[model samples]
Target: MSSFSIRLYKDSDYEVVRGLFARGNLEHSHMAFRHAISVTRNWLFTLVMFLIPLCVTGSVILSILAVVIALSIIWICSRYVYSYYVDQCLSDDMLNIQKYYLQRDGYGFWVAESGGEVVGAVAAVPSSYSSEDKHTELKRLTVARSHRGKGIAKALCRTVIEFARNRGSDAVVLQTSLPQVDAWKLYEKMGFRKTLIIRESSLRYRIVDFVHFRYQYDLLANKLL
Candidate 1:
């Protein structure tokens, strides 16, 4: 296994880590789009609706043209909508890492380095949805594609979990989508349990229900036993 180190985030590492976050997420966008296409009934309905007109009119050329237009619209819209969250991460969190994480109490950002180069990152921040002080959120867990399966991601996750425990947190929670199969597996392997799942219901973005899974690791559960 390739050796790596996890350390606190520094201002100098901002740009590289930001790029990694964007690139890593874009890699998964293709899978998310594919899942949406496969599971969303709306896409099938749209195709059928457009085909019915061609069947009635017996105009093969118009039918093909209509199908092409419908597909174009679906593809374009799905890409844009799904990319919105990734864009938000860059705009809100990654770009303002210091203000959002380092500057706050009980919040931290970490980067994994291999051979003196940053290869992965993860963050633990106070959960806004939870009223308990012991609840922290794990976010932005990412690893470079070239360095994956070398325990880099697992190290980053452990860093966040250790950080949370050291700060007296009762639990560390995270959200991952269905497209991130590898990440979900890693979390489960690390003793994180699936606590809840959120499914998209909006009609406009229904093609990619954008399913989100919430996983949590209880820091005190083992100690209390």
Candidate 2:
């Protein structure tokens, strides 16, 4: 809907890209904290603890304290889970953009610019699990908060999908977390089907009720190639 263009990642975009990523990454913390508070284990613990104070002494102050403590615990767990993921991503391929996406064959990174400013970014790489089948994995699809809902995200996704198709990839696969509800919806709207659901094993992830959704867009099925 806005005037924008998608282009290959450039060296000068490094800091801006990472800054956008960090801010966008933190935006989901509220949802993560809410999810952690909703988990059966967490909620039950909080309920029981809060009730204990009321049942023992009928002290409103103590019950309030219990509730506060429970919320604090959930917040800490969610924060840890959120921070760890951002750190891992920033330290990994994102640390050396050129080496990870530009130099590698069948891999790419792109940024969407509007009014000469980067508003969105995405990358694709050969799927490690389905390389023999020529599958590509989409990663790091993000749009700046101020620029969302203007078709920037969709354009970035199409850029990766088309890049994969041109590379002879049979499908484009990607993983999203439960907190990224909008992201999975965009993938589905683009004809990507949910392929797998994984409950991460990390203690912090489990505490926050984090689940990963794997989606695949079959190029052959869509006759896109």
Candidate 3:
């Protein structure tokens, strides 16, 4: 079994934490690609491309090439969707972790360390959509691939929950994407209930069938303290 300790984030762990988050998010790209191809809309689009070539040239080879090109475009678009999110994150709060998380009250970041190496990370901050900041949003929650499935993620989540509860949050909430199947499961296992789902009409989300899920763990309704 892998052993690790969770603690508040520090300046020195910045690069490792950022890298972990990038890698973890990028790992879902393949899922995004598959989802894109599986969507009926994309399938119809690809089929139309294939049929157009076949009807014009009556050549199986050219038709197959058109199908390949369509699929390749979908693949590239899916990857770009994930890459764009990573870039946005790297340029946003992640660009200044200390300012965004450490310096603020009712906001915190934590990392899990094993053998002097940071293996997991999570954060909690006030939910912007909440009325009067009643909800705390769980953020990050990434574990290195090598150290996953050893209770690291669950531990990180518990840390966030404790932090939110201590800060007088009514509930801890989080947002995750459809590509992250494991993430939604982990949230459910930690007593979080799905509160909302959104289907974004933006190009990136449409390319990956990107559906957003919001989950909430009620600190008052449950005995998580």
Query: Largest lDDT belongs to which candidate?
Result: 3
Please give, for residues 103-176, the per-residue lDDT of candidate 1 as tens digits. Answer: 98888999999999999999988976468888889999889999999988988888887888888899989988
Q: Positional deviation of 170 in candidate 1, in angstroms?
A: 0.9
Ranking by lDDT: 3, 2, 1
Instruction: Provide the TM-score for each candidate, comma-separated.
Output: 0.89, 0.94, 0.95
Q: How much is the lDDT of residue 203 in candidate 2?
A: 75
Number of the top TM-score candidate: 3
Any runs in candidate 2 off by more than 4 Å, and if so which? 131-133
In terms of lDDT, the poorest run of 10 residues in model 3 is 125-134
Model 2, CA-based lDDT: 0.88
RMSD of 1: 2.5
Which pairs clash in model 1?
Answer: none
Per-residue error (Å), model 1, residue 119: 1.1
Off by over 4 Å in 3: none
